[model samples]
Target: MSEEVIQYTVAPAPPEPPRVPVRYAGFWIRFWAYVTDLIIVGAINGIILLPFIPNGGREFTIGFWTLTGVISTIVLYLYFLLMTKFSSQTLGKMIFGIKVIRKDGNLPSWSDLVFREIVGRFLHRVLVVTNLLYIVVGFAERKKGIHDMIADTRVIHTNK
Candidate 1:
């Protein structure tokens, strides 16, 4: 009987690309970005609501207010969803030269944009205390907000 010997060889892992340092956006920068977005959205909402707003105070019923609120919300959501999904930046972000990217270093997908822009943002707005989540931008190495964390994303500078 002849005995056969088996040999095994392990290949070395591929060398990773040189690491480029990521420049994180700070709290102040992010705050301004948010403000810019608010102004843009508010302006659009104002224009849309203008026609519907009654001429005098008599029509300011609860139903009118509720309907206005819902319209504003839908417009805001659609704005964020479509803009972020396509460009990874809203007008505010574009102006600020910042953009959202997946934490894993991939470009954000539609679902990621949806979660970050709609779900996470809605929760952040509703929970007033969560507004403090912006503090994380000051301290976190990645300068990620609660919404960014929830959506596994990071806001990054485009110039760099």
Candidate 2:
């Protein structure tokens, strides 16, 4: 006696949708965002330092650093660090509809934010000469500043 065998076939999976391309923010937009951020930071520092400035705090110096200068630096670092850590963008970036993202397409970690905001940005601001480093953002193909490159990050538009 001969036995009959049946074969079952599975259907093919559907194709995935096409991916949209990412758009990197250019220098001009980034510059405007930075300017807006500076205004906000200045407002914050002014409010916080008001009481202390009455005692010559603005001119007070600790070695080469003025009292207000030090405080301002700390405030700046905290603003960038905390903003990027929690939301991956500052108020300026959000207003401009741009955001910082890891080059590998992952969310940045605390260490990455710290490096980008504190260490890298500090280097740029530590001396008058180094501030020119920001100009590189305009020349870089990825529209990354030194700090962004240091942290392996990219600033991209959300179009929102």
Candidate 3:
């Protein structure tokens, strides 16, 4: 009895689509964006709260905390919080063509925004050492700052 040998043929695997490279915004660009944001915030506060400030936004009402200070803090927090929530970017970021994104590639949740914009940023500004933590973005592999690390976020350049 002669047995015929059968050969099995395997189909070639499909080719994967080319991956687009993600560009992380570096420290200087982020710094400039932050400066722009500060200017914008300053303008907003100047226009809206100038009359209410006791001593030209420098009066200390409670242990270095003035009415202007308090109001500015509130506005600052609200600006970051609302802008990131609605647009995933502030006006400064828009000008710079950068945006905040979650590392998991999902839409950022309310908790993420609060943690990043409010708690993390507050910590950075509240302490000198923490403020320096912003420098980490320059060294981090993905260009994440302390706030981005805390919130599992990253700032990336968006296609304009």
Candidate 4:
């Protein structure tokens, strides 16, 4: 029998660029961010009415509720406008080092913010079925709430 030898050459693997691991914030942090926002907005409204609180024992009236509704609307509008225009961060978000940005990582437009804040949020608040659906959809997504999807935005940790 003749002896035979075979040689095999292996190809070099292509070089890959190093990747920086992305860190996502947890649910608790996001929840706290919402709490902070609520507190800040509530405080603003409280401060606005602090001077008008009567010393007498007058029961709250329909006018009071109406005033409150108007103030709340204005505050919400201003909050959304400022966040969309100024790097997608409300005062609470800025404090928490979280910002809202488009899913593609771009600044959100005015229309997007308005739609998310007004229409999406209103629906979420009004329709119980829609609210449940929103929660389910948000959890089903990569942690993006319905409003975030409607606005094409995401909340990311700026400190990271």
Better of 1 and 3 by lDDT: 3
- Cα displacement (Å) at residue 59, model 3: 5.5
What stretches of model 3 exceed 4 Å from their correct place? Answer: 1-19, 55-64
Local distance difference test, per candidate?
0.83, 0.89, 0.89, 0.68
Candidate 1 positional error at 144, Å: 0.9
How do the residues 53-85 of candidate 3 rate in per-residue lDDT, one tens digit apiece?
A: 676544658776777778888999999999988
Per-residue lDDT over 1-160 for candidate 1, one digit per residue giving the tens place of the 0 to 100 score? 9999999999999999987777777788788988999899999999998876777654444654666788888999998888888888889889999888898777899888878888888887777897777787788768888778878999888887
Clash tally, candidates in order: 0, 0, 0, 0
> What is the alpha-carbon lDDT of model 1 when measured against the actual structure?
0.83
Q: Residues 7-39, candidate 4, lDDT per residue (tens digit)?
A: 999999988766544344445666677678778
Q: How much is the lDDT of residue 132 in candidate 4?
A: 64
lDDT of 2 by residue, 40-82 (tens): 9999999988766856434778999878888988898899899
How accurate locally is residue 136 in candidate 2, as Cα lDDT from 0 to 100? 93
Q: Residue pairs in steric clash, candidate 1?
A: none
> If both were scored by lDDT, which would come out higher, candidate 3 or candidate 4?
3
Report the lDDT of model 3 for residue 157: 91
TM-score quality measure for candidate 2: 0.84
- Candidate 1 is scored at a TM of 0.80
